[model samples]
Target chain A: MTDHIDQDRPGRGDGAAGDAHRAKPTSSAFEIILPALGERPAFEVGEAVSVRDRSPIGHYRVPIYLRGHVGTVVRIIEPVLVDNEAEGYGRNAGSRLHYYRVAFPLTELWSRYEGAPGDELHVEIFETWLERAQ
Target chain B: MTSVHTDHHDHDHDHAAIEQVDRPGYYEVMETAIRELLIAKGLISAGDIRHQIEVLDSRSPALGAAVVARAWTDPDFKRRLLADGRKGCEELGISFYDDTQLIVLENTSEVHNLIVCTLCSCYPRPVLGLPPDWYKLKPYRARAVSEPRKVLAEFGTHLPDDVEIRVSDSTAAVRYLVLPLRPEGTDDWSPDELAAIVTRDAMIGVIPVTIGGEAA
Candidate 1:
């Protein structure tokens, strides 16, 4: 249906484009750091991980449904930022980390999921909430 | 005591009678109370609040449409956008109001992308402004990840059985925007024309952009 779309165009699939575009996903080439809290990101793309099951009190971003489920890290958001679990309580005093675009099977997310096996539910999870599931 | 005007300059206009919500909901009441208290404490001025509202109201889906149109017309821009959403949007002269990063998800023939904040109503506010009411409601937040196909069907978006329904539950500060597949017929169309056809729902991934009108 999208024949009018330029099929000859490179980097048209999955939005990955190429490594050229992936140089730095930021507003500018150089970012000024106020205070870097976390070390380099732990997990890489395509790594299997699982969400940490513990629930903390007050203003947490992680949904309860994804607490114990396993997922693959599809994409990693760059420039390690303030942890949401910390920021939600009005401060990100020390916590800062990368966010992983974790993809899980819809069937795994929900029992009796009325969709194909290929269906997926992708969620952006913080480094603190994830563990190596390999 | 306030002075009363002897002559009121009320003109009959082609406007429907302004209606008020029957009652302020829970959050609405809290908002008004907090606002009044804050103003009373002299921490914030009413004008500042009004100015903030104006800034938010100024933002709309047009900004995002312009970005999408640029990506569709220019392959390099598309590549940049797919790689880094915030940087690509900034390249187009679109400003970011928030400190968080924006991620642009592309829809392909094999996979369809949908965005939902199962935890809360987190959207690409810098580009598309405020979300619709349904987006913040319980049902949309609850079922969007669990039963996305059914949700898409409700929005009049139906993909082939084979296409993957990839739902992104934004559980972090990072925001999401669905870079919808540009429709076929508008190959020769200008950027403005392309932008005109891109709807808010398209960016939200609930529906695809069509020439005639929105699906169903």
Candidate 2:
């Protein structure tokens, strides 16, 4: 029954319009930062990472495009300070460190892709949506 | 005038038949599923989704038209556009900064500007409309910043060695759009007629607005 509720909203796809509805009503208390470069945070190649829910503050990098599609961890990037999408509510302020790189095989993304194995699309995605791969 | 082409017809028919069954990609399937789920859950109606899609489809060409028309009749507006793009669009009733701060860069002979969101496909959909499929691809995004001139050349847009190339990266908070240079030979054309030739790709600076039509 809960699944039914997820299906009925208009403009579920994330974009400019969706972001407006989703932006944090107020600033958060914490200062979010990007993970620093050269610091190898440990994660297995095929680990399933859970992306945090980001409906409150609105804008997110984990687009609806890659919700269910699983990708392997490719690279880690330097952390920077930015607003936290999850905690971005009215008057809340905080910062968090987030990973920036992942590699998704083009064939895994588009089943019809005939490119060679080396051909992979590297996307810079926020760490919220990732989970340990089962 | 086909004298002996007995097997050609079969080959053509087979190719056409195969093309028709080329399955949609995973993203397309996921998009459909999400839309269906949203509608079923009462989050939004199917009609609303369709309407949004329709808006995206029509938006690009409409913006192209507006920019082209303004360039033809209003010299002051054109000057303003070159100077400050967001302000110039406002004069024509185009809104850029309501939800996010949008920056408009002009592509002149001296400096050419291109936009890309290396993190995600951040675009000014309100002004220029939905981004094209190609624009959202990883290759275009990655190369637009690192090797803009080479990528532009792939799109058949080759700037001279003397020209400066500026690549703007869109982030979660900010986005950039390009206002292409007005085409020549449109000195006396009406706004409506002039807008007819403005393609979405041109407004993005991947191609130039041609007096004749879309570039070949």
Candidate 3:
């Protein structure tokens, strides 16, 4: 079941890209504040962690299938741009969160997965949506 | 190549009677009207719009291909790219349009990478141009997240069964670019020649670059 039923409008070539690009000046502010904070990522690459099960009522990036599943952090991307809390509303009030590329087993996400046992999918999750694995 | 046509139409029929069906849609008319109105109100200039159009037109897969070629030939650049993608791209004189960070995912003999935007078409437009219509379609978005291997197969890409497929969804502001493994037999090739063989799909991780041939 997909929640993307309202994305029917078609016309490419970066209309949203124009709206968001260079429009927010806090991006540079984030760059200056990030190093000063010296904040370390919560999870390390190859460490097992579980996605937080919080279901917010508004727009979010975390897919529904990955709400409570365990995954391994495959990569730690640099802290840049605002999180969903700010991006969804075009506001620049939230702090930058570390983005992690977590790999999850396809079978774990779907019981009827048809791929091999080695098959897996990765999703970019913010530090706020991840927790230590149980 | 051969041209095939239906035989139902008679050659003697009046071809001049055909009507021209080309016309702008309602939204297009509205867009032009709004643009003209904005220009009239001094909110924006026509030159500014032209400049913005030129900026987008200047971006394409060639920019990304050049970056990959540099990383392939220079070990230090590859290290820089893997360590910090945005900085590495800027080292090559590529400008960043926004604050979004670019992440370079390297493909190896054991691991493969594929990128998608499940929420909306949030892509690295500064490097790669606008995504293809198929990439923006609903089918590709949903299927890529659910069954990436099958989606690759649909694109005529087949990897070894033993190799691992890592499908990374571009769910946020970060954009991912796949650094495909350098093809064999290109040891003596120049960066320009190597870059020519790299396709947009290869950088997207749907297919691999052919060593001595065209797009693979």
Candidate 4:
């Protein structure tokens, strides 16, 4: 666990680095049809979301890079019983909230991103950390 | 380097002269003390610990590969898996050792999904076994969520600029798994043959599963 994969493996990087005009792929998305939940979700799919920029001390699940960023809600995880912040302290007696899968554009995530316009980064953010974007 | 003389060829020389290493970290010492104390108090037996570790070690990437292969061939199973990753795997007799939920992300030409634990190395341990050492390290945890396209390039996965590189950060209770796109020239292959090409990196989303890729 102490070892790092910072360096590339001994016999890898076959696709080569820095190859412009990459070949177009033949396959499409796997396209899994999601069943609807009777219970209403906090935020609907495709809704714009803004992550709160709260700087809480000690154990927290929200990554610093994602704080105060706007994204779209990809999926809503049901049952809403995760308070990993409190659970990390060995106790989970606090109120629960849903963990919505939010998809942020890679360009918005990193300023120097040179990938395609459709590229994105998704993260599971608790309802408390997210609010309806203006 | 030791100079070998032909006169000493009759005796077997010990080339493996490395010293016996001990648990050197503070947590390692603490863990040893607590474990020994617990054993002495008859709380948990050494056999129990060994059994748990064996169970963890036995869980390789093949389990996830099998699920991917099934999804490729069995449309009904794939539908159930995307809806509920835990239940779908459970139907296949894959037992989840923990309570965390597993979210299976489907990869398409439009978007490629990658999993990362920015907060820590949280992974789908029940199916994919332990996370790689690099996965638990600083570089991947930091770069994957930020410069994801560049990170994918490190693994030799050069996707078109139009392809959406979706990086899923396992920051909370949910664990993410990428259901990679079934490569071309694999349509005629059996479930077993398809599974043979589905590798750990493809599942992890660092690389796509190629036609003649190494099996997990």
Q: What is the lDDT of residue B155 in candidate 1?
A: 90
Second chain only: TM-score per model? 0.85, 0.69, 0.82, 0.88
lDDT tens digits by residue: candidate 3, A1-134: 55232223323212343335334444453322222231456577888999999888987888776899999998887754457666667765656667888989878887887666777788889888888897
lDDT of 1 by residue, B1-216 (tens): 233334435874444445563687999999999999999999999999999888888889999999999989999999999899999999977677777688898988888999888777888988999999999999998888888889999998888879999998887778889989989879999999999999999999999999988463
Residue pairs in clash, model 3? none
Q: Identify the superior model by lDDT, candidate 2 or candidate 3.
A: 3
For candidate 2, write residues B126-155 as lDDT tens digits.
Answer: 677778888899999876655666677788
Which whole-number lDDT from 0 to 100 does residue B191 have in model 2?
Answer: 86
Model 3 clashes, total count: 0
Top candidate (TM-score): 1
Estimate TM-scores for all models: 0.82, 0.50, 0.75, 0.80
Per-candidate alpha-carbon RMSD to the true structure: 11.6, 16.0, 13.0, 16.0
lDDT of each: 0.82, 0.59, 0.79, 0.81
lDDT per residue, candidate 3, B116-151, as tens digits? 887778778888888878778889888887888898
What RMSD value applies to candidate 2? 16.0
**Which number leads on DockQ?**
1
Give one digit per residue, the lDDT tens place, for model 4 in B66-178. 99999999999999999999899999998887788889999997888999998889999999999999999999998887778788888988888777788888988888788
lDDT value, candidate 2, whole model: 0.59
Output per-candidate TM-scores for chain A, rounded to 2 decimals.
0.68, 0.50, 0.67, 0.65
lDDT by residue (tens digit), candidate 4, A22-52: 2232233322112133223557778898999
TM-score of 2: 0.50
* lDDT (Cα, 0-100) at A34 in candidate 2: 22
